[model samples]
Target: MGEEFLVNLKYSPDIPHSVDVIEAGGLTKYYGEFLAVDHISFRVKKGEIFGFLGPNGAGKTTTIRMLTGILKPSEGWVRIFGLDTGKDILRIKEDIGVVPEMANPYIDLTAMQNLFLVGRLYGMRKGEIRERGEELLHLFGIYDKKDKKVRSFSKGLRQRLSLAMALLPDPELLFLDEPTSGLDVMSARLIKRIIRDENKRGKTIFMSTHNMGDANELCNRIAIINHGKIIAIDTPEKIKSMSKGHTVIEVSFEPFKFKPGDFAYGEKIEIAGDKVRIHTRYPDDVIKEIVHYAEKNKLKIVSLTSRTPTLEEAFVHLVGDESE
Candidate 1:
């Protein structure tokens, strides 16, 4: 029999070993007496686009810096592709790419030259660098602007060039921080398409962004952090459902005022504006009660609908703050 047959090749392990492309255990970073990251732990699987979300000063950047080896953690561990980011800095860098919150391409060089320079720094030969540069320029939709000085490029173009530089090494992992920060709608959409295409090619992406919409659209899994602490981490659907189960429906009527205490409101009810939103396992029952009250008092119905939970709603619920 062949070696494959002799080894019980008909059967496979229940779980594959490629689950964790990035693993962190109690990862923490301290600057002086302040804790920037407070012992957060999470795992990202291969080919997964993991979204890291937090408001400004929420330690999102600090966590990314530590994972990319720009800074070391004060406590705990971070492993990328099973290699310690701290101990295997050089090896890890060889297979990872980072797009910082800011794109600072060399202003003195042309767009093409910037990419070529990056390729050389990656130890690629001249011919290889030229080939890769052309490929990347085309990939980023800047091939026509290759000869233009980076200083003259628009912010969107510059961002694309920076991403091209990061992709020069064909890394298995990519780290992007606020990549579409200053992009217009069209540019942002293009970048999103590029990210999607890269992920389709089996690249693992670790992304941090203030754009909740993009995070909801792109992430395979998401983690919400606040004040350096992780509040929730899971598939977007699961995270949203956690809030959905406690969702409230609000019905508003003109010339009728109702106090919450009048009814045995569920624990998840809130009073806002001219409406009283209440949460329950049975929205129909709540609606019936509201209709009964309105009819009893002969109230005029203004608006009546069940409020479904959005990712934004889930964020506000978990973060305990509403977005401006």
Candidate 2:
């Protein structure tokens, strides 16, 4: 298996014990009169990529800001690596890596210089900063452009540089906010590769993203938040299973109309023109039943297909009410 596959695989040892690297207790944050986050509570285990997913203005960013100590909560509490963020805000900040949604590397400085400044801000010595900067730039495939001013860099290049700056400290927990946003396919793939590689080194990740594919690809578990609340939180399979038990099979035959009475397959019948859609847990049973019924009724069954629900479908099903 590839390294990406391995990083995403669930191992017995990967299960978390009492030692949660990130824990929030009824975390609520308010901006003026608006409750941006409402009594959210979850624990992110050490070395696990816990994904927070939602649409824009869904309080995902607010929760992240509170956890990272950038914004204090109006109520509740957050603890990072067993240290209370409110009490040890400065200490927690020093031990964490953060990649914000925006790539704001110093526009005037070269990529190397930008990284050097980041290392310095993290309190690394001159030589250490220089070495780490080079290593990170190289790892992110931006070493060749190290001397180029960030202003001259492409959107993808700047994103990679921002990620490198975040990784400079080798922190135990990394926060990535829309890490793959605004990047080309190749650049996004590179960033995803580094994320997996870092997780393999036992660094936990807290990712907030609108990209479901990225969350499904990288996260061991994901929390879907909306309207300042979490709607679902679980493994991808479980979350998807909550909405659908089995695939829906659709069959179409020659232009044949049917009276409501003609379709008698219990709970598995939706008639439209020449097609019938069947909803059932047993694909084989449905196929046999449909075939038998069609044969008995002297109707020709032209085609049949079964399709599993996609995560997008599950998300729509769960959040469709909120959308309305």
Candidate 3:
């Protein structure tokens, strides 16, 4: 089973273990007088998925742009694959694949044609393009649509095609900006699976996402940026531990009328659809109050569960103060 699984592995023998595939020091970007990215420094190890997360107006986009050479940094420096991102961008481009947040295929072309164009741009041989293109089409579950015009495809399919084009080169490193954003459930799930598989096949991926669950699930390490600065960078567990260390009690009752004041121990209370999400340091006390409230109000507890802090909670804790 292990041998079979390793059959598709493409881990590079050239890059040694623990080597930094990407290094940035004091990377900053400015739009006129407004600072878009402050001095930020970080490293991405080879063969790992590193996540960059932030709110909408945060510096995530600017940082990614600088990393991919879309926008030159106002200050600091970036090195990818041991080559300077600014000075050796053309050379660096050869070993990297980039999928922007709003990646798109040529609307006038078919899916297969789009891949062919990417292959040509990468200077791949015709035979190699055909074989690799077919493989990617099948991998992305868009094989049946290879001949279909991209203009007629749905958003999910277009995103799939964009990803396929990015992967067509089989580059050692991938820069994906919101790779699964606005995608359908199945499409999003499929893309996440592909991310894991690609990492297993020895690809280093730098991805940015607003989805905390995706960051927690997919990232080997995460960097949270706020107000043009990186506030926290660490493994998801370690970062989550940095939160107020509250236990989250998710409970839903029949006809819940309990107000936020009802749970005296709850530090934060939020309404999630029909459920109440309560964060409390004193879980025992909050749980008892929930039971008492249910009993007195003649409410039936539909479900109740408790878990430790999540990345979302940690993220909120870390960036809440900076929110406008």
Whole-model lDDT per candidate: 0.83, 0.81, 0.89
Each candidate's TM vs. the true structure? 0.82, 0.82, 0.83
lDDT head-to-head 1 vs 3, winner: 3
Residue-by-residue lDDT tens digits, candidate 1, 105-202: 99889987887777777888888878888988897889999999999998899999989999887887899988888899988998999899999987
Q: Order the candidates by lDDT, highest first.
A: 3, 1, 2
> Candidate 3 overall Cα lDDT vs. reference?
0.89
What ranking of all candidate models by TM-score puts the best one first?
Answer: 3, 2, 1
Return the clash pairs for model 3, or none: none
Clashes of 3: 0
Consecutive 10-residue window with the lowest summed lDDT within model 2: 9-18
Candidate closest to the true structure, highest lDDT: 3
How many residue pairs clash in each candidate at the backbone level?
0, 0, 0
Candidate 1 has an lDDT of 0.83
Deviation from native of the Cα of residue 239 in model 2, angstroms? 0.7
